[model samples]
Target: MSSQAPPIVDDEECRPQISFFQWPDYVVLALMLLVSAAIGIFFGIQARRQKASTDDILVGGRQMATFPMAMSLLASFMSAVTLLGNPAEMYNYGTQFVVIGVGYIMVSPVTAYVFMPVYHRLALTSAYEYLEMRFNKWVRLIGCVIFTLHMITYLPIVVYAPALALNQVTGLDTYAAVSIIFAVCIFYTSVGGIKAVIWTDTFQVLMMFAGMMAVVFKGTVDVGGADFVWQKTVESGRAEFFNMNTDPRERHSFWTMTVGGSFLWIATYAASQAQIQRFLTVPTEKQAVRAIWINCIGLVALLLVCCWGGLVMYANYFDCDPLISGKVKASDQLLPLFVMDTMGSLPGMPGLFTAGIFSGSLSTVSTGLSSLAAITLKDFLIGAFKMELKDSRQASLAKWISLIYGIICFGIVFLVAQIGGVLQAALSVNGMVGGPILGLFSLGILIPWVNWKGAFSGGIVGLVFVGWMGFGAQVEAALGNLSYPKKLLSVAGCNCTTGVLPAPPLPGSYPDIFPLYAVSYMWYAPIGWCITTLIGIAVSWMTKFNDPREMDKRLFSPVLIAIMDKLPLSWQEKVNWPLKPAKKEGCENSGFEFEAENEKVQKSEDENTHKF
Candidate 1:
């Protein structure tokens, strides 16, 4: 897995290897791996000292500061797929893509106020536990299945993208890149649990910034300056935005990026278990809100940087289009190519970029593997089968489960090529998983009438509908039967003396005949969400509704309780009066009680002590 200078081309026909990586890059990469593993080992000793209570191992005893938790959440969500894909998006489509950030205008409030209040009140190990409490076990089962599918599908892209970038730039073998990164990720995550994951994520997020900033500064300087890059991109028609198109078929209009993209955000940021798991890691609701703000603010800033990185790429390749000239096979390759070409002038900078790419990749896989294990153990094995292991045994089993998921994630990388491009593939799969969960959970919060049957039926429909529409269009795009508009490029000044000129461009194809299939991928989450909510409501009317008197108060929202309280006594019974938590005394306990398991381990194995 050690990095080595790749074999150079011997023939004249072979263009000179422009970015051959050297010894310093390998040294930097090794240091990054060592630091990550060391964090795990440090946490391992801490666990041994305290005999590692369940709370400490799983949720940092709910005592982590807001900063690293925020950093971990951001790194977990932003893959190298995003780090590289965003800039390529800016280069090819222009600046209109940045409007996707506007979706957060609603995202911050909705998650902090609506969703956080519920999850924060319930100190469950897995968010899917809410499903069983609100609806029934079957509904909980569906949520777990889709969430498992979503994470399983997503981590492969995280695994593959950085490997692809590093392989192209440093001539590092793709297999070695995947193997080395995941091995380090698995080692840290399996040994350290949640605390190690959070701290290492903080360190990796720093590396990600260092790597990206290195490319941005060097590339910007090489392209003259940020002002020149902007001027050239705008003049060349690569800078664009605010096209208020009403049609849903247009890929990235303000309407689609904001109106449609908001659904994508709410679904993932509010509804997905991967994120909720982080929210529960905090001790208090206030810190949870604080962490959410940090992630939202930090993400927009990073996106702006990646956007500028794209402009720098366009400026540097202004006349010598790498894709057009066949210097790279895909647009995703452009970033690594730019980094290698520009940073090759320095000794260790290329390694820094390589470490940065792997940083995002490793963080993503580590978080996914860790969270999936918790879900598998808590929601599936323990909740479903009533596995009654002692706390120490459960913690040990979690490590084994994490290792298994790491192995599965690595294997999936080989099959992920057919899943679509990096960014589109991730968002579409997330949307498909996220939409139904949002619908199911929204029903739990808003509609007390929805039972297990209704949620189950509605969720299945949302999953099928979103999957069919999203994946169908992705297939067409993959086959080249579907394509998006790209800003024109010219290679007139490439300085290539030998190879023949790029082939002429292909003509555009007709739009898909089915309007549903042609709708922007950004809209898939919204469409699936709407379909699920509507269908769930309709199904509730047709089937047996839950007797509200029999239900637990924690299943409903405080907003609903507030509205019911103001109603007159006559109207109150009509809407199911005496909901348990409506009483002043009972209402104070929002069911966020962390009920520690009674089963105990030997003192030597699990000395549960209050920690600093």
Candidate 2:
């Protein structure tokens, strides 16, 4: 087979070409940079003055308010994926992308009630620290390792999505755009700490909202109106917005999204270290719960706006398809094409959209970089190396780690080109690690008898199975054998006079037959979680290895304890707490007598409480 590029179809001839930005767009770019920098510097000064300890730097000294926390969560989750990819997804696949919001809405309660209390009670700096207290040091280490790997693979793509938008508008190369954006993000995150990240995220969220709203409003006006757009979309059969039936094979059925997909959102928002770390910034669990609700509402609103933007694109092009216009070869390029072509003559509009895209990208990248640094320093470095640092030294280490990870993430952005659609690629990569991580965390929280042996074995097995399933699906899809639907092209606009495009050659090593791709991406989380938890529990029960006494009482949910009580004594004994007599008088204080020669245990507790 020849390695030449595929021949362009006649319809592709009308595709809008993007040229270099003119003067007004440059002014907009300059203003955006200046504002972003100002936000960074202001936060940095505040962080330096207020932060005296590692906690202050990593989690805002555990004193953030609901609005800031909600905004940070919104910004972190939105990312360039939502800004750029959502519109693209909508343009390509209609309103199916909106299904993501369904899962997100249902998952918030899980974060507020189930996950928030455990992390707050423990006063954990990193979510993985819970694993250590609940199971063993090895379990914590595995969780950290998986989280780090996921972020490393995931963060670069976050950077790349916006860079694609900026590249289209400004004619800048992807690598250069990625570097500039990463630098700005690192500067803000390193200087301002979590406070800066949250406050800046709040601002960026506005930018993102404004940019999308601009596209929606102007695009609608230009296309005649909302009614016209709706009619056109319905006529085109792209208005099938709701799918109420249950179909495991269908990607965006209402049942799958609300049930199975909710698990994925819960895994990320509630259990993922990156998100949990954000919630830890709040002063009280009440504030954290409030923040979770705020985030949920905000996310739903944002998703509606995103879906609206998609409808705007379809409506604007109702009479003239961009594909028919030859403005772009792929549906993924439709949104950018619409902006550049329809609004090109209008000054600074392109720049605003581009800025919004970058805002989303930067928000996510900064959070990922900061979280990776904190996790690396606290979970892996301190635990594995048996090294301890004072508050001052730990804070310094965190700053430097953030800087280093920024560079590494910038490097990884190049590989994002290999992935097809931004949303699908992001979710696919996330699921491979997220499923196992969620399984491990569930094992720790809900199953008291999961010993280190079972936990470790279960985690590894879960990771391998999830990876195989996710990657196998990707391979099948690439080969066009998967049941997932491809974008349909209209034959009316085609020019058959040109020789039919030669069939793309098959890979030398192809699967003999396409396996049934019944499992939707949304179900990956629940399926993986079920597999891992069941395997862990069964294996632990068979081995009778975990000593319940070793498990921390605080980590077990009431439901978990009920299950533990029902197990046989031999199994229960292995994992149950041993009985002990109450401490007498000064004996509890004997261990720490160096501070005070013969203080009573109650006195010591009183003194310690008073000191704090």
Candidate 3:
């Protein structure tokens, strides 16, 4: 009586329903698979017909053009993580994520000017091999290990997230989705090699851009207009264009993301085996530089689309709360939900979006699988087995390795699903592994005084330290004991509970404690580098170890040469130098002579003998 008989609510009014999929969505999903398979098969056949050698398969015969190389790089870098994660980032935290593009932009110029020249000049198959020339075999091995670990952990997450998205749109099982995607990718990559990867990546990149623009255009129209949507976003405090104030504890302050993130970007693009290997596929430094600029422009344009897509999500849910409406359960599903709800009725629209997602995911997975196989074959298998695959058989081994690695990655995708927040997890793992590897490479290049012993020791210590810090933060986050430090706090914005419900409650609640020691993810690279270099220099002084005098000059940056020249006479001059130069002029050159001589003298009497 007091409640007026519970308002006589009807069941239909009490429980609202949302359409998950339509016929058009299924049609789009089918088209996505068909197109991806067609591209893969076409390239796979082309690669087999070419009978591409190992070098050709791994590095595109070192003859890639500027446009294709640039497009491949862009496609590889802008995976589903960028396509979906960046927008989700803006929707959740604000526009601070755009600073990532700034860091990426800065990295491109530095890569073109500083890193590309050295990498191109070396013509290395694996970037880590340069470490051997700069320092020692151990340094090279360590670098390869780090790259292997980083790729294994990082690439799986990239593969899995997009599969999850596709699952939402296509109603396919996540594992089935992952298997279909990777099988197509692996088949093409195993057969076609890098040339196949490059050409396919170019097509995927175009699809990515087209799909993203379509989403933007459709979203803008759905939101009433671009101006109205942007205004609503601005008023909601999601369209923050700039935030210059520095706060180390913040996830992304302007200075933190700009300066610190730049170093991380440098590590990934300039020093990483994945990106460096791509650059080396081209024949010359100039073309590599051109590719870098092309990628830079593409990156900026792609990020703008991603950020705008986030605003579209906000605009679509401007009045209604999808979370309350039961449209979706998690924030990750927001964009997919929006696409299905807004454009599901249109012919080919849902398929276009699905195709775009597959393009992003498969492009990334294929590059990763191919690169991982190449690195493993060149860096680990050959190093350990002492067996040489002849030119005739190298492509066969590469193809087999690509197949194996792709399968491994496909399995790892299931594991990645157990982890949360694809972008953050990917970056965190990358920082932990990539930072120390970058530090080691930087030490080898920029600090020549860091001898093999010192470099090895410093790398180990840096890896341990960064691992502890990153893991500790992750644990604290899991325990619900982490918070933004007071100094990092921004003004409170609209607490919109749209599209997703609040995260499920934990087993036990704990007091909120701000993480004062937390630093921006971007800072990890520079910090790790600083730690490794400083430790290396100190350890070198203690141990009195110096690089061999005959090491290649290309391995040392200008700064390192200056440091070496300033060092006073010490044991370095004695142990690292020959007592007398050979009678032949340029006999001591660190080129074919050094390699040939070392190989000849070091090889066992056995005809099959080989050494790394």
Candidate 4:
């Protein structure tokens, strides 16, 4: 499973000021931020007349139109990471990575049929609230904590990816780019709330499509045409896919991208708060589900364009191999370099493209900040305060939390880097944090026997294992240790002064690293989920388990229930058991009931059961 370090090639394209940026570009970026601010102000003003409730700021008062939610959902998913890193992924690894979208497509139906129904029926303000109902407040807290870790690790990378791109594009320091993104993103998001986020996301989505299209089409034409690009790609072996390799350590085989990626999509969408929050902004469950479908379609289309843009980049630089010559400092720099190389002649084109990148980054960061803020207020703070606050107070709290979180996120940007590649780095971190979360939730919704105890234990163990594996791999990559097998390029056709690509440098040759750590980043979520679910189920069975039938039907999975119903009567009776009802007030709580609050416990558990 061990891989050799890539041979380092001499540099020719690594020059300072590869191109100069125009004034129109600045204006384009400026106008995009200004428009973002205006959208926030307008939404803020409208919300005030309605007394600006917490729901208004957090979920757009559940008055958001369909198209906007769809756009925002996809834009948020398109993070600066995706905008810049996706192209880099294709440019380096080839098009096999694009098949990851199959995993994405697989998650949509589950979101519509399983996860959304419970949240919608319960009117959940926070996704973790469902955890509290299914297990206990303690379990909800575990979910909240895991989600916070996920967002904290993720949001910083979101800011850093485009900042790295900006550094390459405009000679802007990463600090300056990070600061500028933070300011605009914080201002608009804090003022406007979710509604502002939605509308701005819509505009940004268009800019994203426009910018990507311009680069792709223009670059394709410059390289010859669509046919020319395809011929070059296939000839270069860059168009290859269907890697039937069964090696668990193989990075992007079909199973890894589609099967492994399917869980990442679940972690990213079905189990994610940013997406679910956007979904709930619409008025009806149907509209929310519609948004989910729209999001899937848009995601595939945008990602495919970005992937093709990568191919076009390859066609244009087929022989040059920018990475070998050091023209590109990082893989992430390839796309920006290509844009400047091809479209730099048009005055506003660079601006439009850069703004387009910022658009994707801003939308994602704002969405995360807003969602994290809501989770903080609803899941963490409000409950911790042990009392209800006024609607106005709650709304104010959400805004302040969002503002503060945005600032905190910026501080983490210093931690971002080209560890391997930004795309893989971000996803590995996401899997580390998100896998256990999806597992915890999956346990809550499917295995009625799972209790807070098993959830807590499983979550901690799963997080530790996945987190360890993810960071170990990243550290190795950062240290030039772990290497993934990839197609090599030749300098024979590169118009260069340098001699034949210096034989790729040989390594000191160390022993193989752990296979667990070598599993592709694509498998992180699935592994994490499996660990947590399996361990959680075992631990729950060892303790006092609840019968799903005795609990709120909404808290469990509709799919699980349907399957259970179809089982033979004898098997169903053998597999299911009733949860023991609460004892007469003198006993210690096993987290099934809480703090002698009989009325509240009854309302949360028994009431829902009665309704079902």
Candidate 5:
């Protein structure tokens, strides 16, 4: 197989390069946009007819279907980066990253049992609201700020990545691609809210699956078969899975991928506003649990296909390395380049693949916009400023907020394109903040003794420590002082001219950076979690721990309550356990409290509502 095949190798033998992008391609791409926009318009009119409130905009009125919400959850987390980057990851580093799915499996139960119950009881619009209920306004404000920064940074990269893919395939300018796609995303998200985002995601995820499957199946067939692809990848030393090295500095080891990756995903699924909002769309805790596990199954499946796709790419280019051959300028560009080489001859197939990449970007960007609007409205305007407004006006403000964020993300896309190298570092740094946020939530829900002071202090310290480590590591890599040992690649069978090939695999050598800075990027979250938890516990004891009985039992996870119940009577008394004495109602929080918490919280919120 010639890896260097171009769209127009010879006019006589091959179709014109112009025919590579035919009318059918544009039609398929247009249908994807129209369908996404129509979903938003449909929901927008429905909401207006009912005079839907802010809650409806943020959480589908808490009446969403489980399967759509499940698809939405999966789509929100799997962005253009995952769609493009995962395969490249496998091609370069081997399949050790596939074990990350195991982490997803481990965290599903934790997200369901530990975090879902608390969020369901609180009936939160913003996940940060739990920070206020468990800690105080200061901690909540900090959390809201971190989330805002994280989303703003992340959303640009999400939109920019697929824009790059579009640029690679269609000769479209990056700016135009970002503008067109982001405009559609913002329109649907602003007008239709969470309902629009969820339905669009469901539609787009199917497109994502179809597009990726096309690439995998077609690429595999062209390369020979699944067995050939597998054998080639294994011969190339890329079929690795279990790497038991315990060294934190070793990238993609079994320990880092599972334990550290679990903490990272737990933070995402259990604490991030975007995902928690998805969980809240369901009506019951059981439905929410079911939705999360369904998301788990879908995520694992998507990851396996992506991993397989990487092996297929390797097989096609085993004798002729694309990067070294200068057929693709970057590793991320390899997938799109390969698509054009193999599938460009088949009209709408190329468009479907492009739409799939764009769909990944669209789903994530829309999700981020919706989450940003919800967090800004609930955490800042309502909670911090105490700006009470009528439900209708609140809904209107949320739409405006969503629109503003969409524009901001679009503008930032240009900046991201300018400093492309830093995107990976920015992503790593996002995890640094994520771990502390997860720690704060974990403390609030699982540890009754942690107080507001402890949470605030621990979060601040953890952020600083992780930030220091992440920045130092990124700087070293940029300076060519840090590098990971990748599986060997060759261009020995190339029929065309080639550039300098990468060095063959070398015995691993530790980077001479500080020991802590040498830790694998995968372990960043685990490090932050440890720092935050240890400091939180220490600070709480010094400040006199929170009284478990004084706090709402609804704030604690059922798992913690069960363990508290089994404690020795003396230990229970010493720790002020039993939370609050069970009434004749029979300690429902102690068992399985399915009902919404006392309506007093809602009553107070309603009383606080102000007319426009």
Candidate 6:
């Protein structure tokens, strides 16, 4: 961190403002939209030719290729919120935020080894089906309902972000742009299904990379070079690389990024229907595992590019902050403002950038719509109501369901537009429910003792606990009683006649509140996971624990089972694992009555043992 404030430097050539959103930009943007729609149409034709089944419509018939699957998984969650909000995060916070990439790295193995194997073996359309298998239908419905609500709240924010960018650079009506984007997404997603969503996502991910790299490349060159950008950022106290603080209330620390952040990613990859459906699209577990690693690599690369774009923005505005000078209305608009300032004059550059932002939103919404359809059909229509239908009818119903969800998402966009600081707001909302959802899945996989009663109780408690803290923090932030201080800003070279905005108050100056409310949003997932797991185990013990010998091994995580197999014989005996099969008493079944019914049709003990 530098001690000297940035000097007042009157430099005109360096701060040239150019009008963007011209004909060339429009052509480039229109090209992306057409290509995305075309992909959906092509896949729709292919599906019709083959007379695709519900499996084909929802999960690509469980035979999708690896590369596209990997890209779709990456694009689905890393939405415009990621592309537009992350650069702003870097600009407002600092490099300490980059440690979140490490969280992505940690998620790969956890998903591949733990969650993937269980889901792959089950081969269910809805990931929530595992909850029912482990507990009962009520648990599965709870998971489905949570996911539906999550996507409803989340998709609107994803769509609104790029619309905000267009409003900033092109003066486009935000809701109008959102409507157009959602219409295209709904058309392709409903027509082409998962195949169309995955292919379009692959194309959009390419656009994302191209657009982000173009900004980074042009911004670095325009700002004098990478070296100058680094120097300026360091001098302005914005090149923060390491903050080892362990305090939960301290935002963007190494501990929060790796530990708490890993929990966030784990919840996303392990439990979220959007990612799980993509994982099941591939032919085998190995391909899904490979795709997870590939997605991790791409994600890290994209994060680095977005982070560097922030540094480049800082370098260009080192002596004149845009927000302080009233050049940009919101932090989320800083990237678009920088794009227009630097690359606006270049033919198609601004359009290419806008296309990339829209691509992120498109991939996300399409995936959400597809996943929502699957959850509705598999978990609710079939699992809850026991509806039976032909494969073609099921596919038709799914498309209609997806169309309805798209419209619902469009309506939610108006609400999301009112929220500020998209990156944190998005993450905070995700963590509030995401933690408990992950905890529910984790309980089923790791704790054989947990019954339906315990699982349901723990999930409800975790959701309430995290929701209380997350919403309280948001209210405090809304009221301006709490905020993380941003990196220093300067308006020394402002050419406009606006008053300088005051620096944010330090964390110490924040109003007192419940300590839990002050905890960083990063910890929400871990906190939810812990509360659910502990309470679930305690409740199960107090009621009726599952008989280890009677429980199905496939429901347990392979990693846990493998570790137990290698444990000392005495330790295994103590846990009552690999024990002699006891004759079942008619009323002594696990509180999971679903499992009890399954016992009658289950395979022989030797067959089950051999399968494990």
Give the TM-scores of the predictions, in the order they appear. Answer: 0.89, 0.85, 0.84, 0.90, 0.91, 0.91
Q: What tens-digit string does per-residue lDDT give for candidate 5 at 108-194?
A: 999999888788766788898878777778988989998898888788887877877888888888789989998899999999999
Q: Model 2: number of clashes?
A: 12
Q: Model 6, 358: alpha-carbon shift in Å?
A: 0.3
Q: Which scores higher on lDDT, 2 or 5?
A: 5
Q: lDDT per prediction?
A: 0.78, 0.71, 0.70, 0.78, 0.82, 0.84
lDDT for each residue of candidate 2 in 554-607, tens digit (9 for 90 to 100): 465544555666888887555454422222221121121111121221132322
Better of 1 and 5 by lDDT: 5
Ranking by lDDT: 6, 5, 1, 4, 2, 3
Roughly what TM-score does model 3 have, to 2 decimal places?
0.84
For 135-171, candidate 4 gives per-residue lDDT tens digits of: 6678778778888877877888878877777787788
Where does model 2 exceed 4 Å of error? 1-16, 241-247, 323-326, 486-518, 545-551, 558-612
Q: What is the lDDT of residue 84 in candidate 2?
A: 68
lDDT of 1 by residue, 1-612 (tens): 111212333334335354677888889988999999999999988888888866676777677778888888888878798888899888877888889898766788888877876776766678888887777778888989888888888998878888888878778688888899889999988898899999999999999999999899989988798889989988877666788877877777888888777888888788877788787777666777788898898788888889889989989987767765567777888898888779887988988988888899888888888789888988888877878989888888888898999898889888985443688778777777777789988888878777777888899998899889987887677666666757656565654433323332332333755777777888888888888888888888798676676665655776776787789989878867757632222222122223422121112112212211
Consecutive 10-residue window with the lowest summed lDDT within model 6: 603-612
User: Who wins the lDDT comparison?
Assistant: 6
lDDT (tens digit, per residue) of candidate 3 on 1-612:
001111212334224334455676667657756666676677667777877677888887777777888888888768887887877776666787787778889988877876676666556777876776666667778888887777777778888877777767766787887787887788777877887788888888988888889888988997799898878777666665577656565567678777777877788788887788789777666677788999999988998898889878877765554434444555566777778777878877867886788889888887887888788887787753557768768778888888887877777777768765777777777777767787787777666556777888889998888777787777777775653311111111213221323332331322344442366566677678778888888898898756445555555554444455566668437545322322222222222222223233223323311110
Tell me the deviation in Å of residue 293 in model 4.
0.9
Q: What is the clash count of model 6?
A: 0
lDDT score for residue 114 of model 4: 78
The window of 10 residues in a row where model 5 has the poorest summed lDDT is 1-10
Instruction: Kindly indicate the candidate among 1 and 6 with the higher TM-score.
Output: 6
Clashing pairs in 4: 7-504, 7-505, 13-327
lDDT of model 4, residue 39: 91
